[model samples]
Target: MFINVSDESITVNNKWERAELAQIEEISMYPVALIGDVLQRLGMMASVIRHVAGKATFFGTVLPILTWEGDNLAIHRALDDAQPGDVLVINGNGEINRALFGDLLGEVCLARKVAAVVIDGAVRDIQELDAMGLPTYARAVNPAGPSKYGPGQVGFPVACGHIVCNPGDAIFGDRDGIIVIDRRLVSSLAAKLKLQDDVENNFRARVRASLG
Candidate 1:
């Protein structure tokens, strides 16, 4: 699912219509657990990836980074190009032999005010990443570093964590797991998620009363 190409400037477009802040905040208020339920058990990323740092909850429009396995130069470009409200949903093709990101990159992302990072591959420096206090999720961690050698793409449609990621799709994550929502679906889904949460809450309250 990955290929190595000579180093060159990636031509993938940088700008895409992102979800609104109001939508993002509303969605973030709901637990991923509830959102997962409302989504009809959809948009879940591969379960192999787990939270390894910072606040367990993170939500933002996806900024996908597609790279050859074990390579990270494109990630640098992504960091440089990322805006404050982006979540870097990276596709390293599930390569685990080399760690594609680590503490150094984590610091840059935090400084840039990025919302979070989700790597569908290996990362390193778990302690430092946690210390930096930014959300990060990855498939695995290794001490081995990545090759900065190029041949990767950024801001493109990519598949990661067993699901397809479109640039600007909304990404939501927490201690429970990660969920992706199509940008166009945000308004509708947010309303549905709230309704579902209310329904579940009422049901749970009723159960408690019956037991009493």
Candidate 2:
């Protein structure tokens, strides 16, 4: 289901199944660190939401933008409504006035088996989230409150960094940066990314050996 609120789109899908084909493609094929390398190659700042701690990696489908006056109503709605392996993309418009997300939300997401949370605004309770091992990427962190007013959407196309995120697009983020692969291109991109990772690792190994 999708909720359209003016400029925002929120998607709610209780069904959670990693696309079998995608999973097969991932498993049968050798893994590559393509997403990380892609960011470095592009010389773009489309990665490393940088606000998270611990194993701050993220990859999954997008549940588009949601709005709140510092209250987490829509966010909660999204949670109760998110499919497993879905990434929650909150468009806070880069607002740093208050904390857009916190430990409680993080806990809920973890419990629901959600993949990650990406916000263009702010998040708080970093210590708890990190302890819980929840993956979150955001512009900043603040200790402010949120509103629970109207005006939020789900299952729509939203913009993050320099990429346009649509529902089901593959979003992968690591230390290097975030890579959004079009759902249609996952198979091809996966192969290319895996190749890139192998080549890069071989180069790194050779360089290390020569230094020794």
Candidate 3:
């Protein structure tokens, strides 16, 4: 059954499902930056969406969130609706003062094995996130916590770094940057990317031979 997070029950839909997104693990092997490069730089999030804490490599289908500045109710709502292989992609409306995510929520993501989190605003607890080895990319860090107010949406398109992200979009992030791909294009694009890699490798080999 499909779990729904109604306007009243994002708090209760917080049940974690057994892993069903195993294919994303295989897709994660593709270099996110290279894929974006090959695609002529489309789907890359804003450069400001950067490494704040945790391991660098991560990729997953997105569960996008939209929240008002200085508020994080949508993020909490998305948490209940997120799957194990889903990256919580947040558009915090560029609010930089109040940190919307932190260690406690990271504990939940860790226990549930959520792939990663990318917030286009702010997050705190950098050291704790690093210690847990979870990949977290955010615009900045702040000590002030946010209000849990409403007027937010979950599982919708939200602009992170000027890039509009829809639910179930493929996303990859590393120290280099974050790249988002349309979910429907993942299969065909991945195949083409593999071919490009082979061609590049052989070209490099020929160059080496000529030099030798």
Q: Report, for every candidate in turn, its global Cα lDDT versus the true structure.
A: 0.86, 0.64, 0.79
Per residue, candidate 1 scores C-alpha lDDT tens digits across 1-212 of 02344447554667688888578878899988888888888889878989977778889988899988898988887776788889999999899899998988888888889899899899999899888888999999898999877678888888888989999899999888999998998988878987888899899999999999
Order the numbered candidates by TM-score, best leading.
1, 3, 2
Lowest lDDT sum, 10 consecutive residues, model 2, at 1-10
Best by lDDT, which number?
A: 1
Instruction: Give candidate 2's TM-score.
Output: 0.76
> Regarding TM-score, does 1 or 2 come out ahead?
1
For candidate 3, lDDT tens digit of each residue in 94-154?
A: 8999998999889878877788989989999999999988899999999899877656878
lDDT of 2 by residue, 1-212 (tens): 12233323333444433333454237223322455354354422354355474356666776766565454556767776677778887766667787778887787787888888888778888888889887888888888878655466566666666567776766666665555655665656556666677788899999999999
The root-mean-square deviation over C-alpha atoms between each candidate and the true structure, in angstroms, is: 3.6, 5.1, 4.5
- The count of backbone overlaps in candidate 3 is 0
Instruction: Name every residue pair that clashes in candidate 3.
Output: none
Task: Name the lDDT of candidate 1.
Answer: 0.86
Task: Point out where model 2 deviates above 4 Å.
Answer: 1-33, 36-48, 68-71, 205-212
Query: In angstroms, how far off is 33's CA in candidate 1?
Result: 2.2
Model 2 lDDT, residue 187, Cα: 55
